[model samples]
Target: MVEGRPVGRVGDVDWLLTGSGDPVTVFAHGFGGGISDTRPLGSGVDGTRVFLSFRGHGGSGPLPPDWTYDTLADDVRQVADLHGATRAVGASLGAGALTRLVADEPERFERLVLFLPAVLDEPRPAEARGRFVALADALDADDEDRLASVVALEVPAEFSGSAAARTYVRQRTVALRAPGMREALRRLPALTAVPSADALRALRAPTSVIGCVGDPLHPASVAEALADAVPNAILHVYPQPGVLWNQRGDLRRRISEFLNSR
Candidate 1:
């Protein structure tokens, strides 16, 4: 059974746990996502899988007034330490947080799996950032129409064609209509300072990256760049468009193979 509780005051971060073993695998979801986003990953993996909701997302409390990658990483470490995590898998912003955690405390995580991580040398396109910011502002203003527009813009192009995507967007929009969402998005700018290519390359733990060919948020070239930088890092490219969050089977196969190899 998955247990939910508070690991720290930033918010009541719930830890979802399954299985029993030494090498606990912790699941970290992306921006605007929660522990439920990791349900597929947990189902795919065989051992202990712990899913955490980042500060301001899901059941976690609002993000600290001042948030940074270090703070996010520290939160992850605290939860991992509490659960004795031996391995970790993170997607997008979560991947950024895990990277910093492994770098700061190498002994804590035995292996790392990063999915469609967001690390761009240049700032995100002004138009895209503006759209997200506008949505956040609208949410703060309690403007439902503007908030829905923002959700539409945030949805990946690939998801546009799927019924699941439509349902997800509606559900997420409703969830974000609450008061704390704007504050959460306000804290997102801090996530822009992702680890440099050299820093990711220097990581000591065995690493693997999963890339989707057409995710605007996390371009495939970024994965290629990291694979080039890190020694022995495995890169798996999927033909599917958008992020790997929706591609459970492919991601599971690649991650399982990589972890077992180590």
Candidate 2:
């Protein structure tokens, strides 16, 4: 249903391939996300794009008991191998997974783009953890009102107050009500830890890290720290999460410029 179809499976995971050209780009979405989350970035690129659903999310299979960032990263590596992809873009947990991939196999990718990376040196914030748990509870109860409240706490204040934003949140929550999602949400805290500082510092690819303000779970500070650690990384912090929705044209331009650069 996303922009591509099921080309094939990679180690119990489903992958979608779209567009066509050299230097295939892989787009991985965040926790509780699917191919749709990274659709914007996938379409922004001029070359081939491969979109993957992490274990238990989107079109992927149910979560395995041994699932970890390393496991998910291996799945990503498999997708790249299938298409001979040389570049990747990921957000939040997806970004974390890509981090692990590039760290383990630096030669697998030529360029990397990470957005709103949810991991850093610090532990997961208590409030953010609580929100995920609450959302799981809401989903189990099929409580739209409760889910809206939980999602609102994480959105930018301005966006949360908008009727359209609230509607979007509720609709998104409803669409995400897939089997095994509750278990995936529960395991998120453990699966989202950032790769080791040494691993980040050792990255050899041209990388760009984007973070947004007003997102407690994925703070700009985390992006700043990553940019500081990766020798060749550049950091871009959006003033607010709302800007991502209202100013997508600008965002597309920024991402296009990055992907097209030499």
Question: Which model scores highest in lDDT?
Answer: 2
Which one is best on TM-score? 2
C-alpha lDDT score of every prediction, in listed order: 0.69, 0.77
User: Over the stretch 123-164, how does candidate 1's per-residue lDDT look in tens digits?
Assistant: 454454565588788887878777777777556665674787
Mark the regions of model 1 whose C-alpha exceeds 4 Å error after superposition.
Answer: 1-12, 120-122, 153-163, 193-195, 243-246
Task: Look at candidate 1 and tell me the lDDT of residue 67.
Answer: 77
Off by over 4 Å in 2: 1-7, 140-142, 154-167, 191-195
**Residue 140 miss distance in model 1 (angstroms):** 3.7
Give the clash count for model 1: 1
Query: Each prediction's Cα RMSD?
Result: 3.2, 2.3
lDDT for 134 (candidate 1): 84
